[model samples]
Target chain A: MIRSVFFVSDGTGITAETLGHTLLTQFEQVSFQQMSLPFVNTDDKVEWAVQRINRAAESDGVKPLVFSTLIDSQLRTHLVKCNGVVFDFFETFTGAMEKELGVTAQRVAGRSHGMGNVRAYSERIDALHYAIQNDDGATTRDYPMADVVVMGVSRAGKTPTCMYLALTYGVRAANYPLADDDFERGSLPAVLEPYRHKLFGLTVDPERLHQIRKERRRDSRYASMEQCLMEVRAVERLFKRERIPFFNITQRSIEEISAQLMQQAGLTRRI
Target chain B: MIRSVFFVSDGTGITAETLGHTLLTQFEQVSFQQMSLPFVNTDDKVEWAVQRINRAAESDGVKPLVFSTLIDSQLRTHLVKCNGVVFDFFETFTGAMEKELGVTAQRVAGRSHGMGNVRAYSERIDALHYAIQNDDGATTRDYPMADVVVMGVSRAGKTPTCMYLALTYGVRAANYPLADDDFERGSLPAVLEPYRHKLFGLTVDPERLHQIRKERRRDSRYASMEQCLMEVRAVERLFKRERIPFFNITQRSIEEISAQLMQQAGLTRRI
Candidate 1:
């Protein structure tokens, strides 16, 4: 049977969604129709949200599963009154924490995503600007400042990986696309010599790389299977020869790639 | 007391980190030293991770808080054996889901981030490409195809917001920077007139805008507080005149900003 899952929150619903998705992934046999109901802070909004949940439960012939991060007691009480198996995140842990720490929670909404620390926000923005400025090996003006320099063939998932690293970890990630000459020479690029120790590489299966390239440039020589195979082999060979750590991202997500990079490279997150 | 908090996982540790942080945020009065330990999948790794956690417990003179998502039962057992208050994510909900759904979980690491759905990956990549190509109003070749077009003054958080929307939600978000001329004209740009329905505006406090621009270009007219106030007031007036919904992202995180944009614009996530 298809289950209806609701991620309800007083703010962005990110915490609810993340925790709910993690829980749902364990139920491999059950399919879920997930919906995010963010910013349900007021009495009227909470009441409206409850009606939606009840409707879902009635239509699906089963109680909907609700994962909530509602910090307000009144709003959370309203949500629990709905016809669903409610997993109240704040409610689950706040009481225990209050007892342990001998203090009460602030019970504020959007505290996690609001202006908790201005310095942290500025640092993240600076890292993002660094990633943008150094994307695709466009500039090496401040290569020494980068936390990690990602190297990969075109369409081997360098740019998005760099962006993800920067945005999520406050990592100053610079990415360089390996060109034909670097592959032909079977060596690292001259410009990357200074930052060799900070390099991380990504390689993909030839078929996947070929498909990705084909989508970017339809039916071109660069998108051909032969070119993809050659590029992948050369890049892997270069990584091995240079003793640079690399990963095949053909079956991995950006989260996996970034986590592996941080662990393998001993990169510290700035924020 | 400053407690030690560990987010341990067999895969990327993202879920552990996200949920642990969310829970910890409620305890505002307590101090925490947080660390993420990912890819602890094997017996040896689990042993090493547990030892590390034990060390932290000893150093802190109290039990560490361990939030884990290890799928393997053996590794989880080992982790719980450590000197910490371990909250096992998978163990907590897996049995309940299995009982409810009448099936065993797949018990796999990195499934959430693996290449499970190729179409989703492709859509995300395409959205990223669109965000890059349309960033800062460089090109509006396919504005009609955009899910949302973000507009703001330079350094008002357009590029990073669009990128977050694209990466996180697979939304084809395009951003345009409002030039001085546009503010002077007191109207939307001629090129953006046809796509007004897709427009979403972002603004920032004059002080915040001044600080951001000062970082980008120090000791310039653009970074002056007077100039920042003038620009912000003009842009806000134009938005009000046009009845365009806008947000002041001076204190909002990218997560909150993206969620607000999606809700306000009624944009559908492509993925």
Candidate 2:
């Protein structure tokens, strides 16, 4: 069955969408047609959202599900009047939380994802730039400043992991791609020797690596099974010998990899 | 006063942290010492988390607040015995949702951020690579494949915005850095001429641009206030003259920018 669902928020709506997606994943039997209505802080926008929700309800022949993270109670009041089953996240929890914490909520809008702290925002941008500049071992001079350095063979999911770490946690992450030189030499790169403490490795299943590389360069030796197996074996051996922590990214998402890297590497989130 | 808060989950803990952070932001008067406990799927991990939460409650002289997205009910039963105010997200909403949808929740662990769908995961990675390859006008050969092309002067927040869009939504967002060449030409770049409908622009206040550029190249003409003003004005005029839709990202976060871009560009999330 297909149900209409909405993630409504006064801010970026990211939190609402994320939590709602998590909750909906438990119901694999039902398919959801999802929409996000963001920046719904005004009464007019609330009315507009109500119209959309009511229309969805009418067309779908069932009440649409509205997962709301709207912090403004007045706006949320307007939202609940719609012909939908509302799961008001903030309203559900904030009342109990206020009594427990013995403090009143500020009820301000857009504070979650807005540029509320300029310094933290700038640091996040700086971390992203660092990841870009230091990608693929472009420069090791700044390795001392890196919170973590990720190493993996080509297509082993290094770049995306580093970028996710930097953007999500404000952690300065640099990545290096291990190639024939490192595998043939049978040792850690000379430049990475000094920063072994911050080093983390990633390896993928050989077949998976081959599949990934084949997409980039079809019918090439680089995408051959022999090449993929050899590189993965060498990288895993190096990681074990050097006592560097590593993860197998063959079955993991970038979010999972980044989070595990932070915990295993003992790297604190800068933001 | 300082309060301890924990975001606990059976998966990456990202959704729990996101929703918990959003709720915490409403209480500006309280300072939160926050921690995330991820991948707590087993009974052993549940016990470990209980010990940690209890310790925090004992040390802080106040009961900690636990925001949990644990999908497994038995694990959550053990968690609530800790000396903390537990806010179980799934427990709070799932029963109601089950009744509304007339289906039982699967109660599967780690489905939210797991690699449940391989095609979706690969598409997200491909989108990230597309953003990296097409960044800063590196190549325009693949412009036709992009959902949107973001343009802005240096430090006006194009690269990061594009990267965020790609990573978060699987949207192929390419960015071109507007430079002296585009301004001198007094028109869109020749490569971008055919893709006017797919174009979006980003602009920042000249003073903000000066500050951002100054951090990168101090005491250089590139960072000069005069240069910043000239570039911003020229690019904005080009946007106005060409009727290219644009946003001033001086006050918006990357999440906000990406969401607004998706709305304005009519880009649908692929994942």
Candidate 3:
């Protein structure tokens, strides 16, 4: 059965959507038509959101499921009156937390993903710039500042992984792309030798690498199956020889790869 | 007093962390030392996590808040025995959802942020690559494929915003850095004229722009306050003159900026 799911929030609604998605994924038999109502901070927007939820319920012939992070009690009151089964995230946990902590919640909105902490937010931006500056072996001078230096062959998913790490975790991740020169040398790049302790490798299946490369540069030797196989074997051997921790990115999403990298490398998130 | 909090999950723990952070933000009076225990899919890991939680509880002389997204019921049974207040996210709502939908959940882990949907994962990667390739006016040819083209002065926070949109929402965002040529011409670049509807401007405070530019290139004309002021004024004027929607990004985080952009531009998230 298909159900309409709404992630309602006073702020970006990201937390609601993320948590709702996690919960919804368990029901494999059901399909969900999801919508987000972000920036519903005021009474008018909340009223509009209520109407929208009720409309969805009427159209679907079932009470829509609402996963909410709305902080205002008045807004929550308005939301619950709608014809949907509302799971108010803050309301569900805040009362218990208040009793446990012997204090009342501020109940303000936009604190989670807003610019509440200037230093933390700026650190994320700085990490992103650092990643871009040091991306794909752009420079070796900044390796000392990097929390992790990801090494992989071209199109092995180093750049996106580094970007994700920086943007999400405030991690200073620099990536080095292994090319023909490194393959010919048959050793870790000389510049990366000093940062060996911080190096992590990503290896993709040869077939997948070939497919990715072909999409970028077709009919070239770099995209050929023979080249891809040789590169993958060489890189994997190098990772083993050097005892650097590595993982296969053949079938992993960026989030999975980043989480594994942070855990395996023991890198703490700056944010 | 400080309290310890744990976001424990069988998978990446990201959802747990995100939702936990949102909830914790409401209790401004309490200080939390938060930790994430991901990949606790096995009994041994769950036991270890329980011990860790118990340790924190003992050390703090208070029950820690444990926000858990663990899927295994047996592991959850083990966790509830720990010396912490466990908020089992899946357990809290899944029963009601099952009853409402008249179906049993698959109780799977790693589906939310996994490569279970290859096409969705590839689309995210493709969007990331698109953002990079089309960044800083790298090429104007791909404007047709761009969901939104962000225009801003150098260091006006375009690149990171576009990157965030692509990574978080799978939106194909391209950024164009407004440099001497565009300012000199006093108009939108001729190439961008046809795609005016897709354009969004970002303006930053001159003082903030000076600070940002000075960090990258110290004591240069581009980093001077006068230059910053002039460029910001010109950009703002251009945005008004052309009626291009713009927002001040002086103090907004990437999440806030991207959310605002998506809402203002009427763009739907592909993810």
Best by lDDT: 2
Evaluated on CA atoms against the true complex, candidate 1 attains a DockQ of: 0.70
Error of 2 at B164 (Å): 0.5
Per-candidate clash tally: 0, 0, 0
By summed lDDT, the worst window of 10 consecutive residues in model 3 chain A runs over: A22-31
Query: Per-candidate TM vs. native?
Result: 0.96, 0.99, 0.97
A-chain TM-score of every model? 0.94, 0.98, 0.96
Q: C-alpha displacement of B61 in model 1, angstroms?
A: 1.5
**How well does candidate 3 score on lDDT at residue B44?**
97
Better of 2 and 3 by DockQ: 2
The deviation in Å at residue B225 for candidate 1 is 1.8
Between which residue pairs do clashes occur in model 1? none
- CAPRI quality level assigned to candidate 3 from its DockQ score: high
The runs of at least 3 residues in candidate 1 whose Cα sits more than 4 Å from the true structure, single-residue gaps closed, are A98-103, B98-104
lDDT of 1 by residue, A178-269 (tens): 97999888888888899999999999999998988897798898999999999999999999999999988888877788888888889988
**Which digits, one per residue and each the tens of the lDDT, describe model 2 over residues B214-257?**
98899999999999999999999999999999989888998999
Global Cα lDDT for candidate 3: 0.90
> For all the predictions, what are the DockQ values?
0.70, 0.89, 0.82
The TM-score that candidate 1 achieves is 0.96
